[model samples]
Target: MDLNVTLVLIGVDIPRSGLLRSGYPDPRTGQWVFSPAKTAKSFNPSAVTQTERRFDLVDLAPFDYDSAEGMTAFVQHLAGIEGRLRLLRARPGMLTEGEMPEYLFRRTHGIVGLLKRLIEDGCTEAMESGAEELTPELLSTIQINLGNLDDRDPTAGEIPEVPHNVPVPARKARKKDRNSVFDDRGGSVAGG
Candidate 1:
């Protein structure tokens, strides 16, 4: 019998040690050791071989928080989806009206997870308080934690304040210097 298999490992910050190491094989066993702590006594024979290809994932760019269009669309989409806003009362143009978008962006800092939590909590609050619409006043009362600390303490690290009416500044263009090695005798090359 013959079998084929493919192993896939995914993570945000995968350590170079342990099974991921591409070190020299042990002289006695001729096997790669997977000890991350570098202790002589600790040895794991299940280390990954150097033949395996490693691909690093590029970090995703943050969402555009300066503009409310993206946040507004996300909220609208979330509400329109089935099983999402079933309990909340139907209100025409409820999410996209007035200061709701700005308020939401300010609270969530354009983070999708935070925004979702805020919306879900706001919906629950609306149902309980008989206020079907999501208002700035209603959302302000709903305290959102950073989710890094313990949930038991409601007064833990709150979401960082995002200033209103302040747009994200544009990134400055990087200046490129002419390669001195390839430069001509006429001072320096005009372009690369």
Candidate 2:
């Protein structure tokens, strides 16, 4: 007979390293879904259930933006935030967590720009902290999507090598003198 002991929570809030997971809206539907990284790692032990219902965080795969759009749209969104978090927190039925991604996503997708802003902010913090080495800790954690080709799957080889079509503006091969039809200079030319 399997005796089911009531699960007890003894401790909480144990911080550990983990991937800053990402999620995005479906192209067909606007619903938010986990990115490949998150979806892939969801099966891992760190994500499934902690020992005695506790988690030891881990980063299996790094989080990032969509396949086609890249991080540009994400950065644009972050940069667009005008420091009015109240509006963002108030949306999606006043649930900040559920709505934050959408709130961010609605504006833009420039991840690299957002990261640059974060680094700039961290630099400000570094300035205020008397140039302490520990100050960079905050800056170190930031994961910026710089749209690097390293993000691609190595097994896939090159990305099909898109042939760029450069349009060359055609210049007039010959310059012709202007002739006015009403000048009547060619009126007798038909006699030939």
Candidate 3:
């Protein structure tokens, strides 16, 4: 906690502009903020679609860079991906701007999985970029935001307690050599 390792991070927003993009709307807030918003353009296979869209904010918080595979994927992306590679691309404004770009690519197309992967990628890149303080806090926030969609664990809300009186085993203390002093060495020639 005391070490001063400065880490740089970038926040990313996936482009939600294609017809195929799908996600749940913000349930409590009743907004399309976090969800993917696909443009409902008249069924046009003819028109070109911008693969990536911008997001709200990006944070480059201090963090510990962990995970090799994650860093690899991020490096690959930075090196350049096949299709539209949408991401925050790292800047101080990312944290303040509150928006990111999303890209539509043919491969790696599982919506939910891909999004999670992208976030993971962002964190990896951030760490590689020398961000020490921002990564953890930023990543934690991203998780908290996205965790909204996940169903809460049923056990988490419940209170825990000790069950019925299953008896605990007892340990015995060793008795001291109390009778040792009373025994005369049996050599009574001089003292007798």
Candidate 4:
């Protein structure tokens, strides 16, 4: 629920060319003027597909940047993965109404796991790196600080299983055949 540190972030630029908009004809000039479009809201009801995507080392807290090449490579690699994930998630109607809750669960679960691993990795890396470069007093401080972090639980704890009272169909209704139209299975859809 509360995170003090931001491990990794991705920025995406949705090009204007990709946006879907509506237009209204002006009564006086007979010219079409742009208006807000419910493109995403109207389009999501008939889609069916769910996927789980994995991004390795999402926030590598314990990553050692001993050398410039290692740091640069790590940054570039993480950036690429983050960028791809952001784009995948940013698309409209990617998560159907039924899938929204599950998507949120997966995303939050993934982030918590990432944070846990990062802390563990950071502790190990810090100890090793500290042994090599840190002074006795500095090492003591590092040990005290990171040692306290070891006991903390990184999981999103105590999630009670709530039954879905609504009767959910085994399969979501699709507007078109899966083969006819592309599904959101780790790839971009045609109009989406």
Give the number of the best model, judged by TM-score.
1
The reply for model 2, stretches above 4 Å from the true place, is: 1-27, 31-63, 81-124, 130-138, 141-192
Residue 128 lDDT (model 4): 58
Question: Candidate 2 has what TM-score?
Answer: 0.19
Candidate 3 stretches with Cα past 4 Å from truth are 1-154, 157-161, 171-176
Worst 10-residue lDDT window, candidate 4 = 48-57
Residue-level lDDT for 179 in candidate 2: 70
lDDT of 4: 0.34
The deviation in Å at residue 41 for candidate 1 is: 17
Residue-pair clashes per candidate, as listed? 0, 13, 31, 0
If scored against the real structure, what TM-score would every candidate get?
0.44, 0.19, 0.18, 0.17
Q: lDDT by residue for model 4 over 55-114, one digit each (tens)?
A: 111222233345666545544543443344322123333222344323222322323333
lDDT of 2 by residue, 1-192 (tens): 336555443221112212233444465765434433323445573553233132223222211466535444443444454233232122332212333333333222323344344445544555565552212234443333334666564344322222123222333468787877667664566758
Best by lDDT: 1
**lDDT of model 4 at position 25:** 48
Candidate 3 lDDT trough over 10 residues, lowest sum: 98-107
Which of candidates 1 and 4 reaches a greater lDDT? 1
